[model samples]
Target: MEIAEILDFTVPLSSITLERVVLAILVAIIGWIVVKVLTSTFTTALSRASNLPGLVVEFLARFFSVLLYVILALIVLAALGVDISSMVLGLSAVIGLILGFGLQDSINNLAAGVWLAAFRPIDKDEFVEVKGISGKVVSVGILATELLKPDNTYITIPNSLVWGNPVINSSRMETRRVEVKVGVAYDSDLDTAIRVATDLAAAHEKVLPSPKPAVVVTELGDSSVVLALRAWTKTSDVGGVQGDLNRGILRAFREAGIEIPFPQLDVHLTGAE
Candidate 1:
């Protein structure tokens, strides 16, 4: 009930002197500063010295920071004249209990993160589709993966989900194929349409020259003949190349008098009932 009685009951004030308490506080402050500086330096050195992926470097930096803080806690406890051996045992028991009861998902995320870092399926700044969400990978953290969508939205996916799902990495390959499908009227000259499409693709600056561009008759629908124009370009230029090819083909088709057909339904009236 009394303040002194409460203090005595809560902490062993008789055994710990004012000087020891002050020393512990100072040690904690100094250790925290040292830990921060050491962590930053280690992160910089590791990033510059090793050729590890950015996600792996980030994960290592975070793990090192946590390890430093743990050591700092032990040092502070030692300065306070606390028995660290027993404290460590007690802490281990507490951690075990937490893992067994409340941290199963957290543990899985951590393991998944480690696997993601080790295997390098996806990395920072790469465009990927995971679990039906498509975006550029911003970071792979201990618990989750962050992505930046095209609309500038930020999304966080649990590492467990990311690891469990198939990751479609668009930026992994250097070259990508761009295909544009166009339908021409049945009366249109198929050879001329194909040549026009191929020419448009070949004229695009981003399109690769080695494989060359080609046009193939994909399908003969009820109303039109579908032609597919396929070209190879650098992965980064795929969108631009596709757009350019589409626009160029449309314009060239008009100049060449090729008519692109639209869906139409034919109906006949029954005179006799």
Candidate 2:
């Protein structure tokens, strides 16, 4: 009779244990399925928006989904009367500490990059002068931005530096003014030089006539009078026009017999004197 009673009691307990085990397994499987479904739905929705790059959106979706699944797994384990909160809490603390110590610089730089990319102090494909280097921007990546220099060299500057410093964008304006100083000999005709310079500027294909070209005698130097010739050209043509103007002005001066005088130092030997 005693043995029979013990066997009956043990059998009910065994049945209860089996039931809990099955229930927990079913819950885990359901959780996995739900995670897969949720991630697929998220990706589809994000892709339909299409505002951002597809690869970037997909990466974010998958990352968040994995994180959510981790949390879900912990919750299911806790529901089964598992005291894993302490373990989870400890793990979170350790991860937080490691990130705080190891990735602080990266986080700061990343945040600055995001700010720059969003606000656009400088944009991709624009000409910007930063860190004393001027170039056309090629790529704006997370950590760095690449530029193609005027001389055809490639430059990569960190976003941290770009965001931290001032940037000068030349391409922002439709036109840019160029100022050139052409000096003539003190004895040469000042009015003629001014007229030649203005006419030379007018002849250039890139120079704009209005706000009409301006020429002024800025200063009288030791050997010559300096004429400041100001003209406007499309921002894209600055380099070629500048070179062409210098050559044209020189050629015109030579043909017109307008002497561009070099500085002459009148040195005398005092002791010999």
Candidate 3:
């Protein structure tokens, strides 16, 4: 009924009493407030970090949340007059054992995850060729990396593999060169063939102006003369430009009477028929 009476109360530390109950309630309230503040602070900080990957940010926020709550729980237990040092040591030992043997792959993945998040070699929705696999990145997760292939196939590669392999980001550059190689019959005018290719490349809307597409005589094959037509275009327009140029070259060559050569053989009966 009185403040003095509440303070003067006496009971075993292990046993619940009015004073202990009141202290425990206060401890719980304060711990809850601390948890809320810590969780919010950590989440806000992580969200504002521009360099961290999305998944890593989320993982770190959640990890800190779990870790903070665990700390608060230990504080609450201490307030209840329970010693937690031994418990902590024992828990640490168990975790160490688990990590040392049973969870090696998980640890490797976690390490790789950190590297992926930090370096950011590849990003979501970008086309990449890594470890002989080509696809658009879907998500880079803590344990695995996901990719969506051109055919709509989904691939899940472990983070360790993703990080270890060389990554080629096709979309990273603004422009890419598209090369079209064609061969003409030996009898066809090489100058005429080169003019047609260079003209088509220069006239294409998607091809870049500064590079100035070039037609080079690459080789003299047994059946035909090979010409290499190389042009630069925006990365996004590469496929379209390649297809259009192929079709256009075929039509142009036909109209110009420049024969696109095919292999043929003439055999004469000398000793046997």
Candidate 4:
């Protein structure tokens, strides 16, 4: 009778309850392992995706990891006979309210970042002009974009503004046009000035030959004739080539006895006398 009592005490819980508990434990373990494997795979794949940025890939990976963990918890709860409907509904409602009110700007920025990542309006090390700001793109992020200016200054612009405004990417192509303006005295030979400027542009090693550099009389100023020397060069060499052209033109003009004029005012003293 004592042995029977011991068995009865040990078997107080129903078989079904014991099975549910065991099942819940097993499922939880399995779900955890699966979540880890899947999240790793997902993160690796997202990182490889060409259109996605590093920040976005990382954000998505973390988000999905959390989501998978939540799902695993819900599954474990269901196996243990816990009602999750009301919990899910309540949690969703709270999240929705918080996101709706407090995270509007964040959501907008994230969306804009996604758009930029997908479309790729600007890229790293590329020169860009956007919203009156000019710089080289250093990095792109979910919240903002970083730019490095010519003077080594850094500018951070919100992704929303970057996506919303017009973006001019100067380094998007292999070649870019560089224009150098040379002004000469009105008495200088117009044809000779144009010839010398065009020759310098055509002779530059960085300048492309196919496009063929040209010189044009662009403007007639009060003190000088503004001649524009236009040439196409590799995007990476545009600045250096421009400087070279300006210096070469100045030297050539001096050798040729062409005078570059600056704006000046001559005063007459006849009224004072």
Specify the highest-lDDT model's number.
1
Instruction: Order the numbered candidates by TM-score, best leading.
Output: 1, 4, 3, 2
| Tens digit per residue, CA lDDT, model 3, 1-273 | 798687557665546456666787798899889888988888788778666666567656656777788888888777766669888899899999998889888888878977887777887678998898899988776678889999999999888988888899998789999999999999999999999999999999999997999999889888889998999999999999999999999999999999997977778878865
lDDT of each: 0.89, 0.79, 0.84, 0.85
Instruction: Residues 173-254, candidate 4: write the lDDT tens digits.
Output: 9999999998899999999988988888888999999799999988988889999999999999988998999899999999
Candidate 1 yields a Cα-based lDDT of: 0.89
The digit string of per-residue lDDT tens for model 1 on 160-205 reads: 9999989999999999999999999999989888988888888778
Off by over 4 Å in 4: 1-91, 99-102, 267-273
Instruction: Return the top candidate by TM-score.
Output: 1
Give the Å shift of residue 10 in candidate 2.
32
Q: Measured by TM-score, how close is model 4 to the native structure?
A: 0.71
> Lowest-scoring 10 consecutive residues by lDDT in candidate 3?
8-17
Instruction: Report the poorest 10 consecutive residues by lDDT, candidate 1.
Output: 5-14
Candidate 1, residue 170: Cα displacement in angstroms equals 1.0
Which of 1 and 4 is ahead in TM-score? 1
Residue pairs whose backbone atoms clash in candidate 1: none
Model 2 over residues 20-94: C-alpha lDDT tens digits?
455567888888888889888888888787775543454456556868788778867664556796878988899
Give the poorly placed runs of model 2, Cα more than 4 Å off: 1-104
* Alpha-carbon lDDT of model 2: 0.79
